[model samples]
Target: MELAKIHRLDISKYNLTFLPRKEEMFAEMLEKVDADDAVLEALKSVFPLPERNTDVLLHGDYWPGNILWSDGKIVSIIDWEDAWIGDPLADLANGRLEILFQLGKDAMIYFTEQYKSVMTKVDYSNLPYWDLWAALRLSKFTEWELDENILKTMKERINWFISQAID
Candidate 1:
């Protein structure tokens, strides 16, 4: 479905900063991923981001778990607590990372292609940055879960996104 209308609420109301601000949490995540200073420095450079026009409502936590399907169709999107008006790519990036983690890179590619087919106004150049943002956002939670495999996968995904952002 296309987002044909914009929301009246602005992003600032959500207290949504693009990147994580908790130094301790970020440091812990970096240690878990074995991310070096260079990586952290690179991420820092992208912050204080230039203002972009908010064109649609973003499901701030868009992931497979939040989506319900029936008869091979999306029946409902259940979560709205984190919803806000912001860059639509943020939603795409969150969904993309979760799909990549659950499925694979190819599935993410397919999803991206399908999304782009309908969302013509998408600025692809900003996706990698958003992807990195999503990864970092997820890292906070993934580290706490006791599953070793999931933790490893999350680290790999975060590093991969970081590499993409740096490139």
Candidate 2:
């Protein structure tokens, strides 16, 4: 999203923040995480609540692999398919899951803390919604992967997605 508009340009009216009020987005994540039902249910109720962050620049797809490094130093971030104008926390939440799985949990925590230090206006509570949303997308990918394979592998991935919630 346009973090600049929210912070630098001071344009909040055109922003669109979507944190849905349901577990459907998050179900795949809860399946993989085995997140407690009580917690997910509570989040289902709270996920739709709004937290505006006008100035935070979001990388659109802030996942770990997207954040490029060269010779042990940071270079550039890639992938802008989902980039838009909205809450930066959504990107943070979406990026966190990819970081945790692709970069390891410790690094994810470190990056989160580092990002937290730079955040000024927005609360990061809406992260779960974003996390769930990404998980659902992953589940769809899993479905597509299943379809591309033969009977056995297809069955396996399908079962995995079902166990994860998008089958």
Candidate 3:
């Protein structure tokens, strides 16, 4: 709700500017992944999206840890450094992926529903593109910081999550 509200704010009056859209960054990162040929192709197809209105303010890093709570209700949503002025789907996709990994697919679906319930007019055409973008962005989970068992589970989940986007 808070994120949707943020997106709804009339920030058009401010002269804020964001860097080039993230597709270029996604392209650069994709080259290093050694992903399956089909997966790579699917990702490539969505890039250089046709120019359109990018009015919403994205909470570029919308995930669990950034949401703060006191008692029970959320008191704050910290971490604004990654915020950007772009497609609202970026935040929704990233939030969905985080929920899938931290909680489960059911929770991710519920969260998506809650978000959409507020953002009634959102066009979800690029949701798959952004989901794959998020999955790639968060591929750092494949790192060595976690124990082997946890890593194994997360890797499998990541692959499944990727399949969800591609299929």
Candidate 4:
């Protein structure tokens, strides 16, 4: 619930804000991925995410890379440029995808379950939708810098998550 603690903060004085919906951004990102008809159809109805009761400060670009280590302990977190005030799920979704890609599906599942346990105060209906959002966030990766096998596995994982989301 570390993230939720930040969300629970009163950052109203900062005047931080984010789009009420990500439809425009996702629409443009569509061309980056080879999504099928079912996925495309699902996108149409997933807009304006099932917003939770309140918005909070988000480390929008949270992931492994942003975390700094010092003697095996987390010392700091960088990359605050993408910070925004929005649904807590947005950052959770980003971290989930990062774990899925950087670690693996099992790790991702463990991480998600742990997050859910910590975040029991909020409704979870937005989770599946956030999962889809996380999957699509990777869709915009065009560099393909990973090894062939790794890339293939990531694609399979992404597809699996997408199928789960669309269902």
> Which candidate number has the best lDDT?
3
lDDT rank order: 3, 4, 1, 2
TM-scores for all predictions: 0.71, 0.55, 0.86, 0.80
lDDT of each candidate versus the true structure? 0.64, 0.51, 0.78, 0.71
All candidates in order of TM-score, best leading? 3, 4, 1, 2
TM-score (C-alpha, index-matched) for candidate 1: 0.71
RMSD of 4: 2.9
Clashes of 4: 0
TM-score of 3: 0.86
**lDDT of candidate 1 at residue 78, scale 0 to 100:** 77
Could you tell me the TM-score of candidate 2? 0.55
Higher-TM-score candidate of 2 and 4: 4
Error of 4 at 70 (Å): 1.3
True-vs-predicted CA distance for residue 87, candidate 1, Å: 0.9
What does candidate 4's lDDT look like per residue over 1-167, in tens digits? 45565667887676554433344445555556665666665665766555564766778777788888889877788988767666777788888888787898888788778777877776777767777766666675546687888888778877787777667
Relative to the unseen true structure, what is the C-alpha lDDT of residue 83 in candidate 1, on a scale of 0 to 100?
64
- Residue 167 lDDT (model 1): 85
Q: Residue 23 CA error for candidate 2 (Å)?
A: 17
Quote the RMSD, in angstroms, for model 3. Answer: 2.2
Q: On lDDT, who's better, 1 or 2? A: 1
Model 2: worst 10 consecutive residues (lDDT sum): 158-167
